[model samples]
Target: DAGITQSPRYKITETGRQVTLMCHQTWSHSYMFWYRQDLGHGLRLIYYSAAADITDKGEVPDGYVVSRSKTENFPLTLESATRSQTSVYFCASGAGSLTDTQYFGPGTRLTVL
Candidate 1:
């Protein structure tokens, strides 16, 4: 098991609904990232934060939002959930550029019907 884990491993919501996926890591890292895996899109970065209170949008951040308040906690929110946004979401944390390794959480499978 990883030190990092995502809450509500599985979730089902209706279109236009709002959903939030929680992520927590035991190993405190300066950087945390959120990614979504889709059929054709593969895995795309949604958001990332370099440190507490410093976050930036990633490849796909139009329909989603993320916040990093503390070093070990990062949460992602879907402002207006949609069917097309259905995908497996992953949360990861990494040390500085030295390790070049990211510990990933299990992943949250969300279905928007």
Candidate 2:
């Protein structure tokens, strides 16, 4: 009730299907980010929003889409999920200050078959 939360904690879908992962934060942080964690690799940023209505692509942006029309919600969509998209997705929020800490959601594990 006081932190970030992600929906569909686990999912299994076929290739080419569209998948949307939801993230909501209770702190109303100004900065939100989407990251992907694959086996044997660190988390890779897929997208980020500095504030509501302002978003930017990160390290890996292809095949993914994001929107932030509200400050507390950031939704990540896989336009066409592929096997390569199988991984754990994380949603995080920060206070937008240098010293502020980033809070992360539990994470959503997506498997594309």
Candidate 3:
């Protein structure tokens, strides 16, 4: 992926409610992923997909859900927002392998209250 961007750069939501973060890429990368940036955890992968409809869970995917209905769109949803889930979320895409370069989208700042 060469270009990526996220929508609703900042969001505030109440606990137990659902929130979805949108990510779009201009390039058609084979792999896309969602990661959360927290104070202590640094960057933790929430979920990833190799292709459309082929998804997999990552390090911290418990409270999150992801779907890639198209090559350029990957949306991450928080099933039930919680304070612990408050963090900056980033979406990234890569060519195919781990060694390939990846491009990250502008992060979404989510605050759960």
Worst 10 residues of 2 by lDDT: 95-104
Question: lDDT, candidate 2, residue 72?
Answer: 94
Model 3 lDDT per residue over 29-80, tens place: 9899999998888889899989899899998999899999998999999999
- Of the pair 1 and 3, which is ahead by TM-score? 3
- Descending-TM-score candidate ranking: 2, 3, 1
Which sections of candidate 2 miss by over 4 Å?
Answer: 98-100
Report per-prediction Cα RMSD to one decimal.
1.8, 1.3, 1.7
TM-score quality measure for candidate 3 = 0.94
Per-model C-alpha lDDT, please? 0.90, 0.94, 0.91
Candidate that scores best on TM-score: 2
Whichever of 2 and 3 has more lDDT, that candidate is 2
Can you list the residue pairs that collide in candidate 1?
none
In order, how many clashes per candidate? 0, 0, 0
